[model samples]
Target: MKFALVLVVIIGVVSLVSTILVANRVEAEYSKSVKRNLTNLTLMYVLLFLVLSVGIVWYIVGVR
Candidate 1:
């Protein structure tokens, strides 16, 4: 349906924009702190992955 198509487009745009923003922020932080502490960086990535995974599942369920 047209509604579903529009929803998909909107979700895709939001995901792309958020991903780029988060990546840029993460890269900046990593560059500054890589030498200071590696554990924090590793934890951040793990948390980010979990958050994204949950978001994807939530979105998929909502769509269905």
Candidate 2:
């Protein structure tokens, strides 16, 4: 179904982003620069994901 496909795609992307970008930093030293960079990246990615999800849902709903 379209809903299932969309859910899978969104989850897949989120999982990939978390695994690739966020998980690797857990073992890293949290110096000021590294912490700031990580925080910024996390915020950017979260906002991007939210905007993308909203856009996808809007487009899908409007298409019908």
Q: List the lowest-lDDT window of 10 residues for candidate 2.
A: 19-28
Error of 2 at 58 (Å): 0.7
Q: Where does model 1 exceed 4 Å of error?
A: 1-36
The count of residue-pair clashes in candidate 1 stands at: 0
Top candidate when judged by lDDT against the true structure: 2
lDDT of 1 at 43: 63
lDDT of 2 by residue, 1-64 (tens): 5777679678867865775566457655656666676677777777877787798789889998
Clashing residue pairs, backbone N/CA/C < 3 A, model 1: none
Worst 10 residues of 1 by lDDT: 33-42
Per-residue lDDT tens digits of candidate 1, residues 1-64? 5577578557756765565465556666575564344545546555765786687678888999
Model 1 C-alpha lDDT versus the unseen true structure: 0.62
